[model samples]
Target: MVKNQPCIEIFEIFTAKRLHWVVKDKGESWTGQYFRDIILTERVFPFLKNEENVIDPDEVIFINDKAPCMRAY
Candidate 1:
């Protein structure tokens, strides 16, 4: 951001049926403990558990994919 405005950062997850979004103030590092403790345990799991989502927690799977540009060349 320029001197007058704030910067924004976001993280997200999705499937054909739904989308989840996380917004954080700029420069917040998503360390492992923070990710496991807050993001998944507090946020995502709850979202998935919501009755409207009709999710079976046992069947959910997560995958992390690097951007093509970040892959070995």
Candidate 2:
């Protein structure tokens, strides 16, 4: 018998009147390295860099909810 049910992590970003969705791959979990390397580096940073998404990249702020992966380190 399985002790745990299957699940995936997903989140959404708010851009003024726009909404952007981000979902992790199936069977994968969010880890500190993955968060630093992939999510922040590959995905989030690029999105923030785009002028269409942000007017001033440096002025953008992040408010962490103290996620497990973030505290994992």
Candidate 3:
């Protein structure tokens, strides 16, 4: 990682035999609002919409380890 060069964050889903991933630009620090609005909306949503992946939106589950930026207060 380089300073001020913009970093990328990846969100991945693993099924029994396959993996799905979404990549997005990351900021210096992640905030709860930013995580949802940018990462979830811009990256994850579009990735989930790819028909080739055979993902069911209703069956999708999101899990985070209670990172500060992922909590809703």
Candidate 4:
């Protein structure tokens, strides 16, 4: 029953005012490096920079639930 299934992964980033997402390329794995490079550096940072008001990085807070792939060594 799995033969016709399409392979895709959805990644999302949300703020109080904005939401951003990307669909993974076929066969790409959701590794920690991928999260940092594609999700954080590519999508999230660009979105923050385009907002009308300036946002200080030091004042921002990030909360995570300790997902295995998201932990930093």
Best-performing candidate as measured by lDDT: 2
* TM-score, candidate number 1: 0.60
TM-score of each: 0.60, 0.66, 0.48, 0.58
Off by over 4 Å in 2: 1-3, 67-73
Taken over the whole model, the C-alpha lDDT of each candidate is 0.61, 0.62, 0.57, 0.61
Predicted candidate 4 versus true structure: per-residue lDDT over 3-68, tens digit per residue:
868776787666666676778867767898987797667766666555442255434545445644
Best by TM-score: 2
Error of 4 at 25 (Å): 2.4
Candidate 3 lDDT, tens digit per residue, 1-73? 5777755777676543357676655443476777688767776665555545534644555555664332111
RMSD of each: 7.1, 5.3, 5.7, 4.6
Residues 13-64 of candidate 2 have per-residue lDDT tens digits of 6655355666776766688787777777677666765667866665665544
Error of 3 at 28 (Å): 3.7
Clashes of 3: 0
**Candidate numbers, best TM-score first, in rank order:** 2, 1, 4, 3
Against the correct fold, how does model 2 do in TM-score?
A: 0.66
